[model samples]
Target: MNDFEFHLDQFMLHCDAKNLSRKTLKSYEQTLRLFQFFLENECKVTEIKDVKSWHIKKYISHLRDRGKYTVTANENTKVYNHPDKRIDLGREISDTTIANYLRNIKVFFNYLFQSGDISENPVKGIPVIKPKRKQKELLDPMEIKRLLSAMDVTKFHEYRLWLGVRLILDTGCRVGELLELKPQDLDLKYNAMLVRNPKNNKQRYVYFSKRMSNDLKRWLKYRDRFSDSEYLFPTIRGTKQNVSNFEKTLKNIGDSVGISVTPHQLRNNFAKYYLLNGGDMASLSRILGHSSIDVTMKAYLDFTDDQIRQKYQRHSPLDNLKL
Candidate 1:
């Protein structure tokens, strides 16, 4: 292999050794490979040492101009079944996606510099690309109630999905973490579940409500009669449910009920409602498994004017006074 390809492989090996999540590793590889391809073809610079800040800037410009799904690192794999292929091709890529690509590229170059493979980091001077924060659409109490009522709980699959929705809403746990849960992970006494496999690779406990606790108990008994899967929520064949499958299932259910829903949306709603109901930022940060309070604040602090007014009314000292 060429020097560039060799260095890329080495970087990936280092990431793998560090036990990075497969999703994270895949993102790194994809971003690096695309950048490598650009370097080789557009800039005609094959050597790792030859890449300059200008080349990196050129790449950023190219990315802004390039349409989505217009190119792939592996041309052969483009024919394979993929979600991106299903979408309309050649649309302008989003700024957020470009920012992610830049972050991944920075990480790769930083690794090389830290490992002493490079004399200087080309990405060191590159300014961090902050993606524009969009307002998160959250489910209202009435909409949530409507979603729950729409589920036909008599059917096993529907009942399982219903409980899954409730669990995420109650605990604010990720769908992936929820799927990884075994019965043993649950602490019924404390109304919490142990999230052994979180996105950041840090384990934390996510608590549910008393109402959720009772529902879980009922579901567990019902689940025992049907499947003996070790996973708390599994497919009909007793296998762990895929995240995409669960998302699609939830989407279809939402479509039927005339509302849009996804697993992440449920988690976001949990955070929003939690804050709306007098929950503090520090505790919310810990509960959401964020690395710091700043991250949590950046995410949930963009409250709309209506939401801010509601919070102000509820927390106003004079309004609560009996005098």
Candidate 2:
């Protein structure tokens, strides 16, 4: 087999072996196509062996040149830190999209080098340019209530629509983790849930109130009657539901109620309220299924501060005594 074909097969097989997601595979495919196109059109080369570092430099230059345009890289790489300095060539691009493209290109080139298609990988020296990660906004209690109330419980789809939001608010579970839940995973006697196959392949138990147990009992009763309710949170039509559809349902419920609520926000609210109501940091961490108490403390530090102040003001022994 030819070098080009061999490299392609090796890289694709590696991607499959790693169990990369479909979305990631698509991005890799696009990057490889772009690399081939650059070699063909930019360098005026017909063969893969003809590709060179000069060609990659030109690609970076092309990206930088786009930043000079009105509606280009500048829009993507907004100077969140400095408004005056707009030159990306001298510094770096803050656009996650551009960084991804560059990284993908480098990975493709590295794969070619490993497959014996190239003598050296030019991308080896180039650093992975990362962007500023934006802070996620947590949805407020009113916003969550609005979204939950807007769902029309009369319809099967709508009943589940609110249930998804409520479950997350009541129990701080990721959307994928929540959907991955099975009917038997819920432990009512313990007031806890076993999150199987969690992030990093770690299994953890999370606890909730007696109210959650009642809610689960009702949901389980309804679920057991259905022929296709093997999963804890089944689809409206009673089949396994995907996270995307569940997300869309949350967004739709928000639109109907005139409030904004996402799956992350729902979980955030639970953590937020849990901290607000005098919940211990370490215990809340265990209930949220967080690997570290540091994560729980950091995320809800403000809530803890408020809780401490409230308790001090309300239950201080000196308050009952005469001054």
Candidate 3:
């Protein structure tokens, strides 16, 4: 292998040794491979030492112009039947996605520099890319009610999904973490669950409401009759729940209720509603498994004018004071 490829492999090995999540490792590989392809074909620079800041800048431009899904690292692996194959093939790539690519490349180069494998970091001179934050749409209380009411609780699968949705809304736990939950992870006495498999691989306690605690009691009894799986939300076959299947089921249920919803939307709604109901940033950050308060603030601070007014009315000094 060439010097560039060899270095890339070493960086991946380092990341693996550090126990980075598979999704994170995959993203790093994809971004670096694509960058390497660009360096070789566009700049005719195969050596790792030959890459410059200008080449990286040119790559950013190339990414912006190339559009989404127009290029892949391995063309042979492209699945014809995949849903993403037809999605916005030539549409302009979002700045957020391009920024992610740059971030991944920067991380790889930073690893090389820190390891003393490279004399200079090509990515060090590149300006940090901060994409404009998009406003995340949240489900209103009425919409959430409709979503929950649409599920038929008589059926085992629907009941499971219904309880799952409620748990997510109540606790703000991620879908992946929820799926990894075992019965032992729950503490109905304290109205909380231990998130053993969070995105950052750090375990934390996520709390729920008393009403949700009662619902969990009911779900556990019902779940016991159908399956003996170790996972809290297992399939009929007594296996762990699939994230994609759960997502699709939620989406289908939302469609039946004349609304759009996803596990992420439920999590976002939880954060939004929590802030609206006077939850503090630090507590919210910890509950959401965010690394810092800043991360939580940046995510949920884009409140609408109506939402801001609601918060103001609730906390307004004039209204709260015994005037």
Candidate 4:
């Protein structure tokens, strides 16, 4: 193997040793392989030391020209037969995806530089890709009610599904973290649930409402009847619930209610509603397990005009002072 290939393998081993998730490792592998292909053919650079910042810029331009969803191996060849149907022929991929690829590449080069293998990081010179922010839609109270009503509680999994959605709406937990929840993590009496495996790898407690507390009690009793698994939400075989399956189930519920909803939408709804009801941003940030209040603001601060108007009416200094 070439120097680049050998170094790539070593980096991957290091990543694996660090216990990085399979998904992250796969991304690193794929991005490096694709870049290697580009370097060998387009830039005609056989050695890792020969690569420069300009070559990286050329690669970025090449990616932009290829458009979205269009994967090129060397420089001229385009890949088809991808799994996602929405990926059209030579469509321009979203900035978010391109940003992800760039970010992965940056990480790879940073690792090489940090390990003293590389003299300097070329990726450090490249500016970060800032994609246009998309506003997340919030589910109205009526839509939420209809979604819950759509759940067929008579069925086992559907009953579990109902409880899962309600819990997410109540606690604003990510579906992955929610699925990771164990029975012991639940403190129904205290109206709190503990998230052990959060995205940030930090454990935190998120509270539920009194009404949700009662619902949790009911779910616990019902869950004990069938599932002996450690997970609060387990599949039929009692394994931890899959994220895609849960998303699909949520999509089905959304279809029944004539609204497109997602697990994240439920979390967003919780945060938005919490803020609309005089909740503090700092507390909400902590509750949502955000890295910082700024991160929370960047994501959840995009309230609709009507929502802004309502918040203004309630909190307007003149109105509150009653001059």
Best candidate according to lDDT: 3
* Candidate 3 lDDT tens digits, 256-299: 87998889888998999998999988999999988899999888
State the lDDT of candidate 1 residue by residue for 1-323, as single tens digits.
89999999999999999999998999999988999999988989888888888899999999988888877888777667563756757788888989999999889889899999888899988997888888888788899999988889998888889999999899888899889899998989999889966456889888889999999999889999999999899888899999988999889989988999889889888899999999988998999888899999888787889999999999998878954
Give candidate 2 misplaced runs (Cα > 4 Å).
Answer: 1-5, 19-94, 102-119, 196-202, 271-323
The candidate with the higher TM-score, 1 or 3, is: 1
- The clash count for each model shown is 0, 0, 0, 4
**Cα-based lDDT for every prediction:** 0.88, 0.69, 0.89, 0.85
Error (Å) of candidate 1 at residue 82 is 4.4
Give lDDT tens digits, candidate 2, residues 57-134: 677766655442223222333556353464553444347767887888888788778877788777766777767654
TM-score rank order: 1, 3, 4, 2
| C-alpha TM-scores of all predictions | 0.95, 0.67, 0.93, 0.89
lDDT of 3 at 251: 97
Ranking, lDDT, top scorer first: 3, 1, 4, 2
lDDT string for model 4 (268-308, tens) is 99899999989999999999998899999998999999999
Q: Model 4: how large is the Cα RMSD against the reference? A: 3.4
Least accurate stretch of 10 residues (summed lDDT) in model 1?
Answer: 79-88
| After superposition, candidate 3 runs with Cα above 4 Å error | 80-84
TM-score of 4: 0.89
